[model samples]
Target: MRAPARLREDGPLRATLVAIGLAVFGIAATQFTTLPAFLLEPALQGTPTDASIEARTMLLILNFLGFVLAGGIYLSATDRGWSYVDLRMPTRRGWLYVAAGVVGSVVFFVAVSALVQLLSLPTAESQVMDFVGDDQTMVLVMILIVFFFNAPAEEFLFRNVIQKRLYSAFSRMQAVVAASAVFALVHFPVYTAYADSLGATAISLSVVFGGSIIFGYLYAKTDNLVVPTVAHAAFNAFQFGLLYVALEYDIEEAQPAPSHAIDVVLALC
Candidate 1:
């Protein structure tokens, strides 16, 4: 199956608009998926300062489903089917990219953190930090969620769907940049929840943008969805694991840096 002629023949302007529209719809769909989590909130209320594990777990699961729903709908609408996504097991060379992606992501985050601190840029912490508190168990659960569900879902929507859609009218790098921008923009509201100023929000979004570019690039280079998905999952899982260690050992330095918290809720989109 193939996409409609209009979609396949889209000029730059039309492609940009369509890609943005699809991205917006995907974001809305994911947000809508979290609605049911609210129902569980009252029933699963925890301490006043913390969200219940049940509620958090429900939200994570719903988020995964929502992203998958968005991707599925797009494929159906375009008549492209799952085959259009280029999903396959990674080759040995692809595995090298996966390793590079994971390591590069960590290095990128560390470099960005150092730059932010050096420049004294204002940055916002994720609201998730409040809910996580000192709960190592919650952090452990989040690690599992990010690895198994969150990373795969977001990669499917943003990289496989939206980025690939843009390729009809843009260069590979252009598509990656445009899709990364959209990914970062969609995350704005979540970061703003704890932002004290626009600078703080911008800093957080910049990190997201950079990280997304890495994911997009991996997808483009490998032409294998699992490459980026596993890379994304491993990076996020690493952060959550670090947080768990921080909570367990009370190592402040081991805690996620300001923008690093963005990964914690990246799937909550």
Candidate 2:
């Protein structure tokens, strides 16, 4: 499906504005999902850490709905229905791309971890790690959540919606880069909660940015949202699964602690 005529006619400046507006709306909608978590705060209080599996699960479900709402509202307003985004069952070749995307993303993550360790770069653990915190049950549940909701929702909004929209004016590479920047920046608040300093936060954001770039490139190449969605989901599921193993076996070196060198590799595995 072609983009709406209005969007097709947009110049770079106008397209960039629209992409930014959509990103802002998407971020706000997802943030609104946290309101229900406040109600759970009473139950969540006095936890060893601030994270609660129940609250986190609820929030992720709400976030999935919120992202869908945001994307739907924007598409409706723009007269571009859901079909405008390239979401479909993957073709055989598309499945190959999906496999490549997943493996490439994992390799990229490992490379970044090694780089960080070799340089002793300041970094922060993802806030999601806090939600799992030595709980095998939480890790298992979060693995499902990341696969079914968290990864798909974020990919739908960022890669399918934002990156595709940017294609109206920007080249594929440009759109991918821009969408990735937005994706990374939107997670700044979440990362900051666990980051010790601005440098640490920046490093965390860099990792997100790099990962988003991989997802965006997959979407651009395959022209199918499913390619990136599955890849992203698998990447995230790997992390949660690794965390589960760490908790189950009491693998102290593999726990996602920012101070541990091996944790970085395992965290992204």
- Model 1: how far residue 267 lies from native, Å: 12
Best-fitting candidate, measured by TM-score?
1
How far off is residue 224 in model 1, in Å? Answer: 0.7
Candidate 1 per-residue lDDT over residues 172-264, each given as its tens digit: 899999999888877777767768998899988888899999999999898789999999989988878777888788898667853242333
Show where candidate 1 strays beyond 4 Å: 1-8, 43-51, 257-269
Local accuracy of candidate 2 as per-residue lDDT tens digits, 79-120: 889877787899999999999988998897788878888999
User: Clashing residue pairs in candidate 1, if any?
Assistant: none
Q: For model 2, what is the C-alpha lDDT against the true structure?
A: 0.73
| TM-score against native, each model | 0.88, 0.86
The parts of candidate 2 lying over 4 Å away from their true place are 1-8, 44-55, 256-269
What lDDT does candidate 2 reach at residue 152?
79
